[model samples]
Target chain A: MNESLRNIWTILKRELTGYFASPVAYVFIVIFLLLNGFFTFMLGGFFELGEASLSRPFFNWHPWLYLFLVPAAGMRLWAEERRVGTLELLLTMPVTAAQAIIGKFLACWAFLALALALTFPVVGSVYYLGHPDGGAIFAGYVGSLLLAGSYLAVTVATSAITRNQVISFILSVVICFFLILAGWEPVTSLMVRWAPAGLVELVTGFSVMPHFASFQRGVIDFRDLLFFASVIVFSLFGTSVILRGLRGA
Target chain B: MIDVENLIKEFGPKRAVNGVSFTIRRGEILGFLGPNGAGKSTTMRMITGFFPPTSGRVRIGGHDIAEEPIAAKKLIGYLPESAPCYSDMTVNGFLRFTAELRGMRGAQIDAAVAKVAGLCFLEGVLHQSVDTLSKGYRHRTCFAQSILHDPEVLVLDEPTDGLDPNQKHEVRQIIKRMGQTKAIIFSTHILEEVEACCSRAIIIDRGTVVANGTPAELKARAETAGSVHLRVRNVAAETLKSKLGSLPVAGRVSLQDNPDGSLSARVFPRDKSTRADLSLSVAQTATQSGWSFDELHTEEGRLDDVFRAITLPDSVKNRE
Candidate 1:
């Protein structure tokens, strides 16, 4: 409905404003850029890879980098409202739970996009120094956006469970780490050996790395896009349910 | 108009609101008077559709709160207890966000924000972040947000809790003015506020409506057996005492010595009597005794006594 969209926009606008008004957004962006840049240049050894593309270093460490930074960004999404007692005011308004969830998620995603956009200089540096596939770089950015969105969804759900921001951050990190680890060969092979075949495949498919991997390869498969979209939608739906249950309580 | 029918809210094993029912006609200022933890806030939350009742229903402007919450909530402007607000946003930003959330567009949002700011006296602090404002300013900002929507019904919980005496009076005036057109329900523990602002009151204790009536009606119930205080001058103490002792209306009369040539006597009636009858009888007696009456006043019962009597069990349990 038009009213629902308006409500969601209002929530998103306020949340975005809240982020910019505080130093938290800027601090998170600086840290994200600094850490990602450091890992790409120093640890991953961009020159050692001897590749024109940033795919070897830039796209490789995104999942791990987001494992920490996304939680830091999303921990206060709902936790701060609960801590300050503003959740009651928000819920009492003429808006539905779904609108609030989507609105908050979009706000967090937009902020993450801003942080991602700040890495333009790195993109420029890669282009100036050596020839790279523009399509792959575009796919890499899309994959990073999807990964951030998926992590934000998980963090939003975690934040709804408690008023303590630290606990929300820790819980989100643990969950996201598990999802990331499931996509790696070492974990999937171990799961395949012990677990049922369907369960192992399901777990691996649910992992962020595989879907992200497909995108990083410049392959925009419908299945991989659907996987990320499903995660975002499912987690936001779960957050709405949790919030509704809290209000009922 | 607002109607609540036998509303009940249970938290796990405990009932927060129990079979509470009330209605607010258009343009009625109903006061919810109760001690802390007496289900006032819970009832308000249900009416606002913030929380669903375990059973029963709340209807606002023909919309059921549980079934059609958005429509029901659109009719309500609520100022919750302690005035919770976004501390990081400026007052202007918060109000503007609230206006937009209420579906105000373009210049309409700005005008609504300006109107509420003016009404709540928040213009000076419009640019200040909510965290930087004082408690009074924070409360005003919250009030502004609630009224910005121009809802038909207003529910305010402890709206004047942290305000000073002057601020409380000013807020009361605003509420009084608003009540002229809107159906307003506000909760308070202060009995004097009820006497000053409320047209009708519902007194709850232990999640039950112990009393519901106009202020004078509640006071009258408390004073079913009335008492009077009389001060007599220009008459001997013995003469005044004998005259008081002979009156059939005086159930119990006690005399005290005054520094001036006057006697202070407290008279209790055997039956409930109006203040007019008591004054007339006392005046006739003073004239008959040739004693000039210095002071004659009727004592009205206080709501505090009723509250103490009703909530004694809860108070005892809390203490233990």
Candidate 2:
């Protein structure tokens, strides 16, 4: 167990440093921050809402923002390794494939978390403007991070499907797009107009919106947490299977 | 130690490696030689635990690779064919990462990285990112990573493929020195490298072992082995051929006219295994004929000839 942790930590450190070694990290952080500021202040109309809560303005844009950014950040997770032929070097080391996958996922997730954390000034802004439920704000942050994790995990699986990063990125975005539109209010209403009610509910059950919305309302329901955890676990597990199949082939 | 037993790998309907087997004890260097697509890389990958054999087992230091991959891999240092490294990392960082993955502590990681860097002559580029390094430097950086752990078994695939002549010599020297203590297997298309460093060599063709022997033994299988070549002045081609061919020790005598008007004759032994008496008999014949000769020597045979004889298509081999 201790050896496994050490292995995971070693891979994590290397992967995390890999992000910082190139200009990708800085550019990603800058674009992420700028986009968040733009959506929250200019488009979402945080001032017009006249509410102390960040659910509408800041947290609401997270799912869409991550739809693009998370895939971009995670596309290189396995694709670059395969393209550069480092996958052999990595797997031949004295570490399990699971350790390498988790380590890489956590590193990219932590980078996303850092970018999300950089939005702290907005949290401060809400606190300054009016009294707000700190628990609710914290819940929103957790939900946002989970949403990003789900997208990033899906990206990780797609990254292993091809050695080309662009293909991985496009695949992740298309998959996440369906996850978002499935439970989206307008899409559900459109489905209700022509489809059976059970089918609509069943499809929306796969959507991430309802789960993320509950977190924004400060309800840390176990079901919602389970939904996000399962997404991460399932996709990472798929990544490992795909990697093994590639080696086997 | 490295032990590969009846390893077989199939991708769909195509068998990449077919029931290939070999064992290397400590302090032995086994050179893997083969033509293109002969499964050398596939065999090395299986031994290093990168690819699980479809059937069979690879044991490293008594641990079965398929059953205990982590433990088995811990005992191996592999330099893959492409010599891959993380281009995003500096040489020092890359080596440090590999050392840490090998379970070294902080100071130990630093020391190991430094040791391999010096050994691979990577100190100059240790601070440079991998993408910026030359092909040879990149190859050495990956080679350094393989030896960072000082593994009990070392598998190198074309370790000197991209190296200049001097760098190739240096890498061969390193492999020779390390082979004194570790079980080592390296594959190459260059037959001279096998003669230069390998204690034993296995040549594979079409996914199977075709020949396994020492450099000298394999060379002795060449068609020219145990043949004598004589260049003499004032001897007619027909006269030399008939006289040399008539000798009881000689099998076939072929003559060529040199541009300088001297006759060059090669005498094959009646029995290919006997090389000692062929040269002496040719020398005696020349002296008796009162023919002055500029060159008279026995051919030790050549590795390339043997390699081609076994690997080339049957029609091509017959034509040669």
Candidate 3:
């Protein structure tokens, strides 16, 4: 078990270093921050809302924001390896495919976490302007990070399915878009007209919206945390299966 | 240190590798030879544990690759066919990353990386990013990663494929030197490379081992093996053919018209395994007939002939 963790750490370090070694990491970070700023200040109406809480203005936008950015950050994880033929090099090593999958997923998640943490100035502004609930802000950050992880994990699985990065990116975006739209109020209301109420509830239960909303409400519900954790674990498991299928083929 | 038995790999409806098997002991360099899509790379992938066999087994240093992949993998170092490395990293960083994955730590990773860099002649570009390096350097960097752990078994798929003549020679020398200690298997389309370094060679055709032997043994399978060639300046083509063909030891004779109006006669030995030298018999026949010859030698056969003869028959088979 210790050896397995060490191998995961080794793969994680290499992937994280790979991100920083090129212009992609810096470029992605800049774009993420710029988009976050634009969404929060202009479209999200942070100033128009005139509230100390970041729940409505800040955290609410993450499910949509991560739909594209997280896929962009994670699409190259396995796709580039397959394209460059390094997938053979990586899997033939002493490390197991599961370890490599987890390591790469964590590296991208950590980078997303870093990009999320860089938004501290917005949190500081909330504090400077008024007395904001620190607990709720912390929960919002946690929720946002989990949202990115869920999207990234799905991207990782899609990335493992193809060698072309564009195809992987498009596939991930489509899947994650469904994850968001299934429970988005506008889309769910559209489904409620023809669909049975239980079916509508079942489909909405699959989306990340309500679970992410709980954190925004300053409630650390175990069920909500379970939803996010299961998303990550299930998607990473799918990635492992895809990797094994690639080898077998 | 490497044993493969009845290894079968099927991709959907296609059987890429079918019951292919071979074993390599320590200090033996086994050359894998085949036409394109003849399952050379697929077999190498299985031996390196990249792909599990559909029905057989690969044991590296007595550890079953299917069951104890990490242990078997730890005993083997593989340089994949395309020779891939992370282009985002410096050569030094890439080597270090590979070393760490191989279970090295702290100062050991640095030393192993430096050692392999020197061995693969990558010292000059250790700090340069892999993407900026030329093909030869990038290939060597990947080769360096394979040897960094100094494993007992090494699988290199076309190690000298993209190298220039000089680099090819250097890489061959390295393989020859390393083959004295480690069990090595390398695939190449270059026939001369097999003759240069392989202790033994396997020629697979259509997912089967068509021929397997030492360089000399395989060459002996050629139709030209033990044939004698005699070139004479003043002799008529008919006379030379008749004289050489009449010899008791000669099976058949053919004459070629040289540009200089000289006769070039090739005499086949009646028996390839005969201890008598066909060249000597031809020399004696020349003296008896008063025919002066310019060049006379016995053919030892050629690997190129054997490779083509064994592999080209199935050209009609569909290629992927």
Best by TM-score: 2
lDDT tens digits by residue: candidate 2, B1-320: 88889999998899999999989999999999999999999999989888888999999999999999989999999999999999999998888888888989878988888888889999999999998999999999999999999889999999999899999999999999999999999999999999999999999998899999999999999999889999998977788888999999999888888899988998999984556788998899899989899999888889999999889989986786
Contacts from the true interface found in each model, as a fraction, amount to 0.80, 0.89, 0.86
Residue B159 of model 2 has an lDDT of 96
User: Tens digits of per-residue lDDT for model 3 on A107-143?
Assistant: 9999999999999999988999898999999998998
Report clash pairs, candidate 2.
Answer: none
lDDT of 2 at B143: 96
TM-scores, one per candidate:
0.94, 0.98, 0.97
Query: Which residue ranges in model 2 land beyond 4 Å of their true spot?
Result: B318-320
Q: Ranking under TM-score, best-scoring first? A: 2, 3, 1
Top candidate, metric lDDT: 2
Q: How much does each candidate deviate at the interface, measured as C-alpha RMSD after superposition? A: 1.2, 1.2, 1.2
Cα lDDT computed for each candidate against the true fold: 0.87, 0.93, 0.91
Q: Which TM-score values does chain B get in all models? A: 0.91, 0.96, 0.96
DockQ of 2: 0.82
The DockQ leader among the candidates is 2
Per-candidate DockQ versus the true complex?
Answer: 0.78, 0.82, 0.78
lDDT per residue as tens, model 3, B65-106: 999999999999999999999999999989998998999999
Model 2 score (lDDT) = 0.93
| Total clashes for model 2 | 0
